[model samples]
Target: MTELAIGHVTTDCAHAADLAGFYAALLDRSVDPGATEFFATVGRESGAHPVLMFIQVPDRTAGKNSIHLDLHAPDVAAEVARAIGLGAKHVADFAEYGAVWTTLADPEGNLFDIGTGQA
Candidate 1:
């Protein structure tokens, strides 16, 4: 057996609650009530295995993120539009590896990619 499994991805923000709400809306998940002011988690009701956690920090300096998420969706265009409507800003759209994808930034300027699950 593997010693490790995939865990949640964490994001640092000035306002953990706000960022958690943003992601909750975008991902169609709910913010877990166990979260505190400085930490929030977006998790599914069925299970708490995979989650996105937000941690509040005193200062949030602007800089390019070295790591980002790549989400796979059945309809990339629709998902991108929905994310934009939920406050994500569109960055770019491109095709690579026989797949089409769009880049977007969250409210706090965290960049993520949405792509059609094609190869």
Candidate 2:
């Protein structure tokens, strides 16, 4: 069988550059050059899958996101604070599975989580 890997994960937004910029700052990834208002990317496109990609859309995705990203941080609270500073809104907090995590919405309302890895 041919090897399979995710080339990129894309999300649609009214303006690609805005969403891409948010993720890039949040993930500490670099925005690829030549990005236009219609499309943009975070992370180096030359190597690997580039991790994330964004495309412009007429309307935002409706309802809750069917898929979301769960992030890990040594200090969940501090990370959450930083994310909020970066324009992420705190959605809620969860304590289960022997861990604690906080859900946040990006500038475009895409959901993601930040958690304390150890107990």
Candidate 3:
């Protein structure tokens, strides 16, 4: 059997550098110096087991994102507020599952989820 080891996930973006910087700031990590026009990686030493990779694309994104990132927070309400203040637009709110999660879209229209649960 072949063991699978996850290293990183690269998300496609219309503006590579700009989107990469946004994530870098959000995640509080610097973009890898060796990164190129195609991709950027962050969270190399933030104590988070996993890292994020933002990939650049030439075309502009349109419509809704087919896939999105789901984030966990201890305080969903507070986190959602913070995210909104950071240019994220609210898409939906579901609070009946003993958990509150909000879907949001970034400046490039890519969707990501933020909620309270897990670490």
Stretches of candidate 3 off by over 4 Å are: 34-38, 45-48, 59-63, 96-98
Summarize candidate 2's per-residue lDDT along 8-48 as a digit string, tens digits: 88888878888888888887777789787898988656453
How displaced is residue 36 in candidate 3, in Å? Answer: 5.6
- Which residue runs does candidate 1 get wrong by more than 4 Å? 44-46, 59-61
Q: Write model 1 residue lDDT over 32-74, tens digit each, in one string.
A: 8867769988884447666788999887667889888888999
RMSD versus native structure for model 1: 1.9
Of 1 and 3, the candidate ranking higher by TM-score: 1
- Model 2: residue 93 alpha-carbon error in angstroms: 0.5
> 22, model 2: CA deviation in Å?
1.0
Q: RMSD for each model, in Å, please?
A: 1.9, 2.0, 2.9
Which predicted model would earn the best lDDT? Answer: 1
Task: Supply candidate 3's per-residue lDDT for 95.
Answer: 77
Q: Candidate 1 or 2, higher lDDT?
A: 1
Record all residue pairs in model 2 with backbone atoms less than 3 Å apart, i.e. clashing: none
